[model samples]
Target: MEFGLVLQTDPPAAGVVALMRRAERLGFSHGWTFDSVVLWQEPFVIHSQILAATERLVVGPMVTNPGTRAWEVTASTFATLNEMFGNRTICGIGRGDSAQRVAGRRPHGLASLGRAIDAIRDLAEGREAVVDGTPLRLGWVRDGRLPVWMAAYGPKALALAGRSADGFILQLADVDVTEWMVRAVRKAAADAGRDPARITVCVAAPGYVTADDSPAALAHAREQCRWFGGMVGNHVADLVARYGTDPALVPPELTAYVEGRRGYDYTHHGRADNPEVAFVPDGIVDRFCLIGPPAAHVAKLRRLRAAGVDQFALYAMHDARESVVEEYGAHVIPAFARP
Candidate 1:
C-alpha cells in the first residue's frame, strides 16, 4: 500500500519548496496539490517550485477542471513540466467546481468527461487522434509519459475513469464507494485492452486523531463537518435528493438530531459511531472521515485497505488536531512503507 499527502488551500507558497523538501526527508513518496485559486496560487504553477525543489517526490495537481485549459494546451504545459522533471508529472481532471465557475464554464457530464479523457490521453500519448471531430496531435514525444488521473464521483464517470485513466481519485467516498470504483476501473481497464490491476486507486478522506482523546477531538470532528456540511460537490444534491426519502428538512423528529450529533465525533470512546444510528441521516461525513484515537483510526484504515485502496490520502482538516503531517512522516509511514 502507498500513502500520499494533500497540500491544503491557503498553504504558504513561500514554504512550498521547503515543505516538499521536508516531505522528502520524511519519506513521503508523493505530494498531491489541490487546484483552487481562491485557496491560493494555482496548483500546477505552485507545483513547479516543488518539482524544482525535490528529487524523488512525485508532485501534481489532484484535480484541475478541464474548462480552464484545453486538452492541447494542457498537454503542452504538462509535457514541458515532464521534460524538466523527467518522469514526475501527473495530470488530474475533474468537473468544474467553484474553480469552473470562475472560468465561466458549466460542469461537464459523464459523456463530456469521457470525451475529454479520450482527448487528453490522445494528446498525452502523442497520438494523432480526432476528438469530437477535431483533429488533434501533440508533435512532441514523451518517452516517459505522464500519468493521468480522473477525479470522478458518479457511476458513469467512474466507469469512464476505470476504463481510460492511469489512476482515479475518490473525494467523497467511503470504503464501499472506493470498493465499487476500484472494481469498475479494473473492468474498464480490461475492456480497454489494458491491465485492470495497473490502474491506481487513491482513496482520499478526512483523517485526524488525537492521542489525548479529549474534548478537542469532538470539537475537531465538528470543525471538520462545518466545511463538509455545506460541500455541494458534483451530484451531491442529486444523491441526497434521490436517497433522502424523508428529507431532514421536514422530519418527524425535531432539529435536535442535527444539533447534537452535528458536534459529536464519529468515534465514541475509541469505538466507531454506530453506523445503524441515524446521526447525520445521509452518512456523508460519517462514512468518509475518521476522527478518534490512533489505534481505532488505523484499524478502520486497515478495513479500507482490505477493500482495495492502493493509497490512502489522509485529509487533515485541522492541523492542530493531530499534527499528522509530522506523525505520519515519523511513526505511521515507516511501518507502512516497509516491504
Candidate 2:
C-alpha cells in the first residue's frame, strides 16, 4: 500500500514545502493539506511550491469544498498545475466542513459535491462539462489530468464516493470502521456498475511512533493524538443528524463515543488540545490513531491493507510530525514495501 502525509498548510510556506520534500525523500507518495482558506493558507497555491520542490510527491487538498470556489475555477487551478508540472496532482474534495462553517456557511449536500466532482474531473481532463448552467471546459488543457478523490464519512457520501470519485478518503484509522466503510464504498461501486477494485481506498489518521509498548508510553501517545477522535466526531455528529443514532446504519463504534460530545468549536478544529473534544476518551484515541512502535504500526497497517486500504495517509497533526515521517520511512514503510 502507498503512504501519504497530511498537513494543515500552517504558515511559513517554506516549512510546508520542506516537509513535502522530506516526505517524498522518505517514500511518501502523496502530500495532502487542509483546504480551509480561513483556517489555513490556500492549499492550491502551496501545492505549486510543494510540487516544484519534490520530485514525485502528489500534492492536493486533504479536502477542498465545492461551496468555497466556483467549480470551473477549481478545475482550472488544478489543470494549470498539471500543465506546469506532470499530472502529479490530486483533488481530494468534500461537501464542506470547517472551511465553510468557519466562514459562516453550512456544509453543502452530496448533490453539489457530485456535480463539482464531475465538472472538475471533466474540465481538468480536457473534456466539456456544464457548470452553473453554462457549458464550460478548460480550453488550454490538453493532456492534463486530475483524479478527484472524495473524503466521506456518511452513507450517502460513501455511496457518492463509490459511484463518482476515483478514490475514497476515510479520515480515521480504526479497523472496524475502515472495514465497514471500505466495504460500503466498494459495494456501492459494484451496485452502480462500476469496478469496485478500481476505486482507491485511502485511510487517513494521526500516526506517532513511540519508543516502547509500556502503558505510560501508550498513554502519552494517545494524549498527543486524542484530538483526532474529536476531529472525527465533528463528522460523526453530522452523520448522526443525517442518519439518526441508528447503529445499524452507522456503527456504534463510530457513534458511541460522540454521545458525550456536547458541541464543537472551530477555533481548535484540528489541533492537538481541542478542549471541545474532551469527550473523546483514550479508547477512541487509540483506535482512531496509529501510536506505537514501528512493528505495531506495521501490524495495524497490514490489517488495514488486507481490509482493502490502498493507502495510509498520516494526519501529521501532532508534535512528532518529522519523527513519524522519518520512522515510517526507516521502518514502517519498508516493512510493507512491495517487492
**Model 2 CA deviation exceeding 4 Å by range:** none
- What would the C-alpha RMSD of candidate 2 be, to one decimal place? 0.9
lDDT of candidate 2 at residue 284, scale 0 to 100? 91
What lDDT tens digits, residue by residue, belong to model 2 across residues 198-247? 99999999998999999998988888898889889989999998898786
lDDT of each: 0.64, 0.91
CA displacement after TM-score superposition, residue 12 of candidate 1 (Å): 3.3
TM-score of each: 0.80, 0.98
The lDDT of model 2 is 0.91
RMSD for all candidates, in order, please.
Answer: 7.0, 0.9
Candidate with the greatest lDDT versus the true structure: 2
Worst 10 residues of 1 by lDDT: 263-272
Clashes of each: 1, 0
The regions of model 1 sitting more than 4 angstroms off are 9-11, 102-104, 131-133, 191-194, 232-234, 240-284
